[model samples]
Target: MPWEGISGLVNLMGTWMTEDDPPVALHDEKAYVATPDRRLVFDSTSQKTLETIRPEGGQPVSTLKRGDRNNAAPPVVTDGSSPLLLAPFVVRQAGTGTQASRTVAELVAADAKTGKVSWRLRLDVADWTKEVTDSLAISDVGASANVAVVTLVKKGSETFSNPSTTYAVDLTTRRVLWTQETFKASVVAGGVVAGTKRKAASDEYSTPTGYDLTTGAERWHDAAEYFNTYLRPAGPDLFYLDARDRAGGKNRLRLVDVRTGQTRQDGVALASRCRYDGVGAVVCWGRDEVTGIDAQTGAPLWRLPDEKAGRVAPRVSSVWHGRVYGKTSNDCIRPRPGVTSWRTGIPSEIDLDQPWSLECRRQGKGRALAAAAGSASPGRR
Candidate 1:
């Protein structure tokens, strides 16, 4: 598809898609464009220029890319009355050979409604010396409340190792809250979880630590015997998955309350993969059953079938409003069931399982319900 559209009436080149990058469309019917020389936003419908930002001599690169695995911290649009846009800019080093140049990563924030730049911060990788060239790349960017969390990974031609660091910035005042050296990090409900491991140390243990989001104070830390660990944030709690227990029998899932640093549920067996439904429940699937767990409290609210059976159970694909949408195997011919309310513990039958599609729509201004499609997934829910 063409990336630029030339509107002869306005003499402007509006952007739809760029080379190897995704379309940057905002809430107010505007699209963002970043060329090698300039960055601009234009109206999609009218093809009129709204704002333009031209860097002096650096290349203007778009942070919005489709299927970008390199950037762990991608651009994010925060939720509020006036949304904010956080983006990254990369300035290519001007040189040749291994020690000729270094790359710089810049983080910029702007008001989404108006294309005004709020604040710009330059992330320094290391001291640039004549001997060695140093470079840095943004790995991740996550936000919660009024704070923006960023992770920068070091990349260069030198043989020395450079550890990544995570920084928490206050969006209101544009001041940095705190920064810590860690390998990986994520923003949780009330804090940030950072994973740290030593380089080339045989006996070094990897520790996942939690820090306060507002003040960046150390709240809690969990040291693991093994290095392979995963942390997932769901609501007000953090789920720690320890793979060391897999050797014993089953994997362990630890649910820790982010506020008090207390382990609410420890050493729980994980049957299968689980994910938050964005409503108020964590939907998980096991061998032949699907279960819903309350987010606030780590209690299982409702289980399908209500009894153990060999029948293939439906797996939750998406949840919207108050209904859960899932699909079953083709061999199972039983009608699909729906849970009326997780709080009320009621069950009802909706329709039979389709081959591969699921959809949901509102009925006469009522709640949304799941409906089957022939070959596509749910449209809304």
Candidate 2:
């Protein structure tokens, strides 16, 4: 199918056959079904069952046989390293308030064909007081070719506050690469990891830090990427940085490329959120107007309201390949869909640097994009 649509009058027609299978972790043409005790592997298109793994029931291991409790929760996250699947079974060992509790992430590398365990590497994620039983669970993850990041946050909550820990593990080196406090891993690609961090002291513009994916060295930490409005990577090297000019009372969107070490500023006037269309555009969608930013360049390439000031586009949520998919406030009453071509640049809007400024081109209700943009990306083994 083509990427763009010149008009906004499309709607989904019908559905297809569905399954009761739990969400599959897709890697290449193989789909892995992982649970706490059992696993299944099958072909994606052919629907051929490849393997099934059942529990090896036995006595508790020697370590857990003692008084300590061992709970290897379900494998909520899984990745593929070719013939082996990097499935993390987060094991929590409860401890007395005085002895301290322990959490171990035993990444089992199971062969895809035989469903046999090829290797295993266990990492001591964190130790906490008995009172903090579930706060240090692995909530998010990001993995590249060799390095994998596991993010720890409160068990039931989504946002990480106070002190969140994200650890990078080197599968080849068989060790934890580095650990960051008050940091959450977002994207790991192009030999770099990008994520937002809570400032150690102050607020306002939060921390944007980067590190070499292989070397684990501090790479980029710019003040322009705000913690509240974190910019998702348009490409491996392309992401927006909101640079505020205090004296001028305007904010310049600085487009920073980690690969070429280049920085270009544009007044794209994007607020709230942005996501890679998984294609060539970084779409900023929310509220009334939805704008598209060219990933290669920092310029806004398109806007909802055309030169004739058309009604605002749907509160765009998903952009895959190039087409925009979302719902408008009128969905309850009347909704329409549309698309457009490329190369046409989006208009720039300069937001006030200071707070307490309100300008509504149109008063329309909308839902912000998902808070965790590019949170836990599985990597190639």
Q: RMSD of each candidate?
A: 9.8, 12.1
Tell me the TM-score of each prediction against the true structure.
0.61, 0.60
- Residue pairs of candidate 1 with colliding backbone atoms: 72-139, 72-140, 73-139, 73-140, 73-141
Q: What lDDT tens digits, residue by residue, belong to model 2 across residues 1-381? A: 111110111222211111111123445566555443334565657767666544232211122222222222222233443545555545555577786445565555566655567666665554431345444444324466757766654443222233456778776676877877666665666777766666651334445677777776778775443433344555546666554443454555556675443574455645455656555777665446667777777677777755586545654434445545443443211122233322342212222222110111132332321111111112222
How many residue pairs of model 2 clash at the backbone? 9
| Model 1 C-alpha lDDT versus the unseen true structure | 0.48
Model 2 misplacement above 4 A: 1-25, 30-85, 94-101, 109-118, 127-131, 137-141, 155-160, 198-205, 223-231, 240-255, 259-271, 307-311, 327-381
The parts of candidate 1 lying over 4 Å away from their true place are 1-75, 89-91, 95-100, 114-117, 126-141, 153-163, 191-205, 240-242, 245-250, 267-273, 286-289, 303-311, 331-381
Question: Which residue pairs clash in candidate 2?
Answer: 5-339, 5-340, 8-337, 8-338, 9-337, 81-381, 300-346, 301-345, 301-346
Could you give candidate 1's per-residue lDDT for residues 1-381 as a string of tens digits?
A: 113321121112221121111223344565554332334566668777776654322443333233332212223566688776665555554665665555555667777667787777765443332222234455334577888777665553111234456777778887777776644454455555444433332222345566777777777765444344545454445453444432354445666665565666664424344555456766555566556667777777767655554333465444433545544433211224444344433435444334222121111122212322111111100
